[model samples]
Target: MFDIKKITVLGAGAMGNGIAQVSAQAGYQVIMQDITEEALQRGMATIRKSLDKMASKGKIAPEKVEETLSRINTAVDLEEAAKDADLVIEAVPEILDLKIEIYKRLDVVCKPEAIFGSNTSTLPITVLGAATKRPQQVCGIHFMNPVPVMPGVELIKGRLTSDEVMEVAVNYVKSIGREACLAVDYAGFIVSRLLDVVQNEACKLVMEGNAPEEIDKAMKLCANWPIGPCALMDLVGLDIVEHGLGTLENDLGPEYKAAPLLRQMVRAGELGRKTGRGFYEYNK
Candidate 1:
């Protein structure tokens, strides 16, 4: 078992910053890496905003904000971010080739025995593991959207992932005050497979003349779902949902194909809250 003291999060995007925040809040030193200095600044700003909100709600002590911030560092260089990380959680965009390239670089930069965890909702961990020399150390640690607020994480085992890696993933999740549910390496795994299908159907409903708000309301009220699929898809990002659907369709079948409306929305570049537009618009 590798001793996990520091965590490196590749990408300073929405998911990446959230992962870094939670890791730091859990008392793990965190390094959030992106390709540009501006991106790193934006990520830090988001983290600060989230911590401030939590502190204001009394969810955490006011001083906890600074405490958490102190534990986090930002980097533009991959090697500088990952060189000392005992565990690295990658949260880059869902491009298979891009991820494979990163894993190869991380394999060279990260210390020996360091574990690689992917915050992927789609794609297979097995393929990612094959990109690196340390296949036994590659596992999926898929945190839900808005990682700091989500309590569930999918701890996925790749074909080459070892028991030690899975155990480490579980303990890391627990330490961060989240539950880690085990899943086999597969495109979309469990949560994404179920939720993506529902979200796709929600898109179909929209195309069939149901209003997005109405659809969400029905799911929330009638099905007791925490959030309606349309709203959830928006929160997850329309482009991300569409990408995951394409991945699912490739690995599964046409049944997993993204709804035409979803593809259209993605093409329009609406995305989600990040872009201030999606199923619903947000104030920038």
Candidate 2:
């Protein structure tokens, strides 16, 4: 069995910070790396806030929060952060090219036994693996948004990913207290593909003149969904939704084409919770 003790998480955005937090809580030393100091600070702040919430709720002891926070180190240098990593999870922006570039750098810096994982929602794992020399070590470990709250993660095997690598990924996900569901490498995996269609249609409803609040209320009351489509899309970010839909449209069919309203909102920078406005307004 491959022992993974230290994790390197790239990008200090929402997904990245969440991944780092879970890994540290799982008792692994984590290096949370990003390119800028501001991003690193923001990511650390988010982690602290999440830990405080958990402590306040009695989900974890306050001492455990300090212990988990102690295991994480922030870095601005990718090479330095990855030098001794046993596993590297890249949670950068959803851009394929940017992810490929990060993998190319990680391939050179990480140790030989390091397993490379991408938290991509739509990109093919095989394509990402090809960016590095050790394709067999590359896999997609797609954690849902708000990683700590989500209980499931999609574990995708690239064309050349070894069985050993897959097992290691499954073990890692389990260690973090998340259920790992193996998925075939495809455009949107499973959850995102199915969920995107619903979200896209919700956007279409808006474009067709249905009220956002009414649609959301209907879904919540009728479908028993915890969160409505418009609100969910806002949390996921309109730009991300537009990009995922674009990928699906190219790979699946025109049926997956992004609704015009989604593209327009993304263009206008109304990116939901992060921006304080999207299909609805947020107090942030």
Candidate 3:
């Protein structure tokens, strides 16, 4: 296994910020990077809010919160943020080309031994690893959407990823209070494969005359899930849901085709909570 004490996270959106918070809370020196100063600041603010919540709930000591906050360094520079990082995680938007470009740049900038990981939920780790010089040191540590609240992390071992690298990643995630499950590099990792089917079927139900809230309630009560499928679709975003379905279809065959309703919502730019509309609407 490898040591991971310093981490660099690329992207300043919700997932990136949440991952940074969890890393900092685990006492790692975290370098959070975005393309612009404003974005970086926003991400840091999110981390601060999460820490404050922990402090208010007595989940962490005030001094510990202060210490965790201090361990984080936000920046707009990729090379600067990744310098000497023991682990670098890319949380950018889930476009294949964009992810490949970032990985190529990171392969050149990061130390030879540094472990590179992605938080991609559906993309294959092998495809992303193809962009790295030391693919053996690259893997996927797919955290759930609500990183701080989620208990599980999916550890994906690419074809080129070393066994030791996967072991190190498992240990690293465990250190941060997250359980890790190994998944094969594929169109949809285990969770996505199962969850997507559930979500898609729920959408079909809505298209067939069932109300959104009714579909959500039935699944909520029947499956004992924390939220209904529609609520989860809203939380995850129609854009993401659509993109994930496309990816799965391409990689797993027609059986994973994007549901018609999902495509229509995404085409209309109804991106769920962020857009204030999706299968449901958010009150402003």
Task: Give me the candidate number with maximum TM-score.
Answer: 3
By summed lDDT, the worst window of 10 consecutive residues in model 3 runs over: 236-245
Q: Model-by-model lDDT, in order?
A: 0.92, 0.93, 0.89
Residue 69 in model 3: lDDT: 81
TM-score of each: 0.92, 0.94, 0.96
Structure candidate 2, residue pairs in collision: none
Sort by TM-score, best first. 3, 2, 1
Candidate 2 Cα deviation (angstroms), residue 269: 4.0
Q: Which ranking of candidates, highest lDDT first?
A: 2, 1, 3
Clashing pairs in model 3, backbone N/Cα/C closer than 3 A: none
Better of 1 and 3 by lDDT: 1
Off-target runs (Cα >4 Å) in candidate 1 are: 268-284
> What value of lDDT does candidate 3 attain over all alpha carbons?
0.89
Per residue, candidate 1 scores C-alpha lDDT tens digits across 1-284 of 66799999999898999999999999999999999999999999999999999999999999999999999998999998999999999999889999999999999988989999998888999999999999999999999878888889999999999998899899999999999999988899999999989999988999999999999999889999988887787787888788888999998899998889898888888887878898898897
Predict model 2's lDDT versus the native: 0.93
